[model samples]
Target: MGREYRCRIQGGPDRDAIRQLREGIRLDGQVSRFERIRHQGGRGANRWYEVVVCEGRYREIRRMWSAVGCRVNRLIRTRYGDLVLPRSLKAGQLRELNRAEVKALLRSVDVSHSGRRSSASSA
Candidate 1:
């Protein structure tokens, strides 16, 4: 599973570029899930707008945008796994999850059911 990110970027990318992204492009390995959000004045590849991606590959977002010729001005992760970052949370503030929240998050992944063990795990 991959994390979801909403990006606000500078530079404009057009339909063909966006489609190429959604269809999948090779970043580090491969990255997909590119969605261009609709904004009031959004038209061509020169405005700041939102693009959503769901891939946690190393530097995938920035690299992907750069590949398509868009410069990411801002990147925000609104969701990770089953946890959603609250809108009320302010910048530079940290919130520790309560015990229950932590447990729920761990449970959401079901690591125990992933029977294949790595060499480190087998040791």
Candidate 2:
């Protein structure tokens, strides 16, 4: 599961464009689920969208949006796999991941890395 995002696009997307984007995403076959996509609001030529896609599918989501005549100007991943970017963590700040967080992150993408121990032992 993932949270929604508020994205800024070059042009406002109408309902028909959103429909086309949905179709494109489905055709891409990389998305397991596109939970939601809506025009939250906009100003001038910039459009705001609230989108919820399956975890690990943000790239596909961006591609689909582009294919449907929307150029994404900015995107912020509000959530990923039960982890939310903390409000206090400003840009460029670093936060070390705890063991559980690391484990969950790896599990989200179905990846298992045994770390540098195996290489060290071999060396």
Candidate 3:
């Protein structure tokens, strides 16, 4: 697993397209744990989706939605490895993880030590 995203998307992809997406999406890596959480009240039939994907492939989420004829209105990184973004945080904010959390996050990627600090450390 890599970055987990909670995204708000609009546009109504028909059943077939939904099924196609549910089957799997081929980005840089496979899109996993893809699920529509709920219909958030907004214009354009906005809905939320949770998905897990490894590696960034240049706006891969937008590309994935576009492939299914959907439009992503908002995309937020909810989790990375075992680290979950706290709800208490607001937009454009950051938080430092605890030692245990840091360890868990590192373990998730099978890295005991990374030469560079991770952006996940200040999420």
Candidate with top TM-score is 3
18-120 in candidate 2: lDDT tens per residue? 7765554554555344577877778899888878776545466567677678888887776667677776776677689889888887666555585433443
TM-score head-to-head 2 vs 3, winner:
3
Estimate the lDDT of model 2. 0.69
List ranges where model 1 is wrong by over 4 Å.
Answer: 29-55, 88-93, 112-123
Task: Name the regions of candidate 3 deviating beyond 4 angstroms.
Answer: 25-44, 113-123
Candidate 1 vs 2: which has more TM-score: 1
> For model 3, what is the error of residue 20's alpha carbon versus the real structure, in angstroms, after optimal superposition?
2.4
Worst 10 residues of 2 by lDDT: 114-123
Error of 2 at 92 (Å): 5.5
Q: Candidate 3 lDDT, tens digit per residue, 1-123?
A: 567787788876677776766666776565632443333345558877676666546787778878888998888888766788887888899888888987787676655475555566545
Q: Which prediction has more favorable lDDT, 1 or 3?
A: 3
Worst 10-residue lDDT window for candidate 1 reads: 35-44
Whole-model lDDT, model 3 = 0.70
TM-score of each: 0.66, 0.62, 0.68
